[model samples]
Target: MRLLVINPNTSRGVTNRIREAADAMALPGDRFTTLCPAYGPELIVTEQDAALARQAVVDTVRGFKGPCDGIVLASFGNTGADPVRALRPSIPVVGIASAAFATARALGGPFGIVTFGKGLVPGLQAKVDEAGLSDALLGISCVAGEEFGDPGEVQTRFRSELEALCADMHQRGARSIVMGGGPLAGMARSLAPTCPIPIIDGTQAAISLIRAVAAPRGDHEPRRAAAPAET
Candidate 1:
């Protein structure tokens, strides 16, 4: 299945990191293409950034062609998920926050989100409420997702940061931690075992959710299929 993960931020550095991580986690047979917005903020953290990214995503949805089996916003704020869904109305549009809400509810308790910064907590919490999982939400965490770099850098930072995060979750009485955002996109296997409860990455959840949502209809005429028959 061909899935496109749209990073509405202009930062290729961040966009590349998110793409590589998504590629690594995707199931076999799942093809992912990641691209950043031509015009938008470097990274989307606040409401203003989200608005900028939203405009770009709106344009993308309008111009999208090819076989897009599923689409992911590749953002914690989920700037374009709903809009694209409303616009496209065919392909399943999955967002990190929505997927996290699903994973959170499934984990069987209030889920806490570990985002880029505490400031994002309001927006993250709002997403939880919007997903109708507010009743099952615990709260947010410490290590800001935007601070995390590549895998090696994340390992250096997360080796300690993750441990502390887990400890904090334990203190908060959270039964699960949803590592939210593309920036905090790190290996889930290593953290899952040690965490007090379940450790879920919104990136992985969003990817898998997009995969499970079912591929788009092949009826949308592909260039090859649309070619006139040669008599």
Candidate 2:
């Protein structure tokens, strides 16, 4: 199966990180093509930043001429996902935020989100409400520091900060946690082992959803057939 992954932000580092994480989860025959728009915010933290990134996402999808079984919007906020879906109704378009929320719900949560930038909390919270998962949401936490700094440094700092937040959420009745943001995908994978509860990475969650969507139905599954017309 083929998948098109779009990073709404212009940061190549984040885009590359997303690609690497997705590659690790890809099946032998599966192919993933990841790209970022030529222009957009390097990192989206504020509402204004997200607004610009959303436009870039829309433009990128509008200009893309590649063939793929599905598309993955590799951003926790799911910028431009609604427009993308509306523009391409025949294609499957999965967003990281929705994918992570779905996974968290399946795990029977009260799940919390741990991400960068305190400024993004409101947007993240809004997304939770939009998903109709407000009842299942525990809370949202942010790690201090620049969100688009060196990947290794960011991950190291995030791990320490996130661990504390996760523990706090656990005490607050959170059953699981979602490490939001596509750039933090690697960090999520690394931190999951040490976390007290399940940590759902947005990228990984999206990948899992994409695989399920691309997979063939079981032989016993019923197929929809056309009705016969009387002559």
Candidate 3:
């Protein structure tokens, strides 16, 4: 299988990190390709960035060409997802947040998302609500104390802040935690130890669901072949 993962954010550093983590989940027969938007905010830290991510998703699908069997939007907020669907209705475009949330629900629990930016928390709530899994979610929460666009310090600061947020959520009622972004994929497992509950990273959830949706499955195959009539 060949999966195309799109990081709607403009940060190549984050894209590179996502590419590495997502690829590791691929089975031996599968291949994964990752990309970042050439034109968009470096971080989807605001509603404006979400709007731009919608445009970026459209542009990406219009320009993509490869043996792509599945499409994964690399942002946790499901940025650009609905617009992309409007542009390319038939394509199987999966939002990372939606996918992760679905997986967490399937795993069965009160799930919580720990994301960056104060501005993005409401939007994340909207995303989860839109997915119709708000009932399954304990809540969508944010980790404060940093601006996502500060690329020079974003990575390290994001890690530390995410750690604290996950801990707090665990203290609250989050039975399952989604680390909540492509860039933070590598830290999901590490946080799980400190967390009293399981951690569901976007990469793991995305990859697992993508595989499930792609793989052929059924209780039984069709036993009858189509009949050809002689004219």
Candidate 4:
């Protein structure tokens, strides 16, 4: 399937990280085209940032002309996913936050979220509530530290802290933990061994969910009548 993954923020570094995560999650014959809006916040951690990203995503999707079997809004909060989906109703749309929650629910237990900023917790909670998964939520943890010049380096910078947070969540009854930011895309797999429970990468969840939903539709064709049997 040909998938379009949108990083609502304009940070190329974050976009690159999202692309790497998408590539790692892809199945054979899956093609992912990842891009960022030309204008928006470098990161989406505030309501203002999300507001701008919503318009940016809408503009980006409006301007895109390439073939797309599915679309993924790569931001963990799923910034602009609804607007983009509205613009392209024919294509399947998967938001990383929603996908992550769905995967966590399917895994049959409560899940927690680990993200970059404390301010992001409310937004993440709102997403869970929106998806009707709040009842299954364990908690949300935040880790903030020295800023990295390259946002993509966030995962490495907070590796130790993230592992600790995941361990805490596990003890608190979380069966899985979600890495909850676009720049933290690939950290789940990287930190999985250190975490007692599963570390769910929103990007990977989005990719798998998109592929599953798009496959049947993309491969479907009008049925043809079988040749008449010879007497």
Best by lDDT: 4
Query: 220, model 3: CA deviation in Å?
Result: 27
Global lDDT scores for all candidate models: 0.70, 0.77, 0.71, 0.81
Off-target runs (Cα >4 Å) in candidate 1 are 144-159, 216-231
User: Best to worst by lDDT, what's the order?
Assistant: 4, 2, 3, 1
Residue pairs clashing, model 1: 110-136, 116-144, 116-145
Give me the candidate number with maximum TM-score. Answer: 4
Q: Count the backbone clashes (under 3 Å) in each candidate.
A: 3, 0, 0, 0
- Candidate 1: minimum summed lDDT over ten consecutive residues — where? 222-231
* Global Cα lDDT for candidate 2: 0.77
Span of ten consecutive residues with least summed lDDT in model 2 = 222-231
Residue 122 error for model 1, in Å? 1.7
Please, what are the lDDT tens digits per residue for candidate 2 over residues 202-224?
87788789778765323442433
Per-residue lDDT of candidate 1, residues 88-177 (tens digit): 787788887778778878778666776545556777777777788877777667575555444224444566776677768768888788
Descending-TM-score candidate ranking: 4, 2, 3, 1
lDDT of 4 by residue, 72-186 (tens): 8989778887788789999888889888888898997888888876767888888889889988888888886544455767777777888888888999999888888888988
Candidate 4 whole-model C-alpha lDDT, 0 to 1 = 0.81
- What's the CA error at residue 86 for candidate 3, in Å? 5.8
**RMSD, model 2, all Cα superposed?**
8.7
Q: Check candidate 3 and list the clashing pairs.
A: none
- What is model 1's C-alpha RMSD? 6.2
